[model samples]
Target: MTTMTFTRKDPPQWLLDFWKEIDDKTFGKGFDCFAHDAVCNLGVADWHGRDAIRENLRQFIDRGFTAHHDVVEYWDGGSLKVFHGKVRMTFDDPALPVVRPAMAHFFYMDEKDPAKVRRWLGSVGPIEF
Candidate 1:
């Protein structure tokens, strides 16, 4: 089993900038902002790498769905951080007309001296979505 620890510190400015970029890409740019090696679990699918993440985002975009996330809570360690928030997806599905809401957990690991998110783990539900 892998043990994880959480710490509270100020996140680097670049990380925050990355989040903003992701938001813009998903909502405004109609593209994906996650890295190629990003791991995503959103109760529907489990994806790894930037390619896989991008494909998943592409699928969403193809379906005319917009993914949005609000960071309700965050904990930052020097090399690691955890973010918790609500994720909502709004799509043009006539059957499912409302935004789907779920709890989101994001784990980020900083790589090298630049402190970029080398690895990201996200869980959205009991299943890998």
Candidate 2:
């Protein structure tokens, strides 16, 4: 893992709830997490706005990927604020020798306030390089 240091800032209730919905396999219903014009750069692809974000996430789930966050760490500073976590992704594919994990990093900005995420630069990767 790369050495990183970020100020501790817990995610808001609404954001947490959105993740809960995702964990429950109900993603499209959580578009409220993203701002109206938020841009998301998912590792495999990039999307803009709530609709595109929903579509991207749906594709991810359909690829047999499910993420579970083990720990959430936050950081904030002058012009930098983010929350990251190390998570494991379970797959339904029998061909995979073992379940893989990934580091989920979110580079978020304050829209009108910290409660809303303005932009998202997210990355998800398989454990094996």
Best by lDDT: 2
Clash pairs detected, candidate 2:
7-75
RMSD of each: 4.7, 4.6
Each model's lDDT:
0.55, 0.64
Tens-place lDDT digits, model 1, residues 1-129: 966576765544554555554455543222233444556664557777656665565665566656566666678654567777666666667565545455545555535432445456666532422
- How do the residues 51-123 of candidate 2 rate in per-residue lDDT, one tens digit apiece? 7887777777777757666546766642345656655566677566444454565657554765556777766
Clashes of 2: 1
TM-score of each: 0.59, 0.73
The alpha-carbon deviation from the true structure for residue 57 of candidate 1, after best TM-score superposition, in angstroms, is: 2.5
The numbered model that scores best in TM-score is 2
CA error at residue 82 for candidate 1, angstroms: 0.3
lDDT of 1 at 50: 57
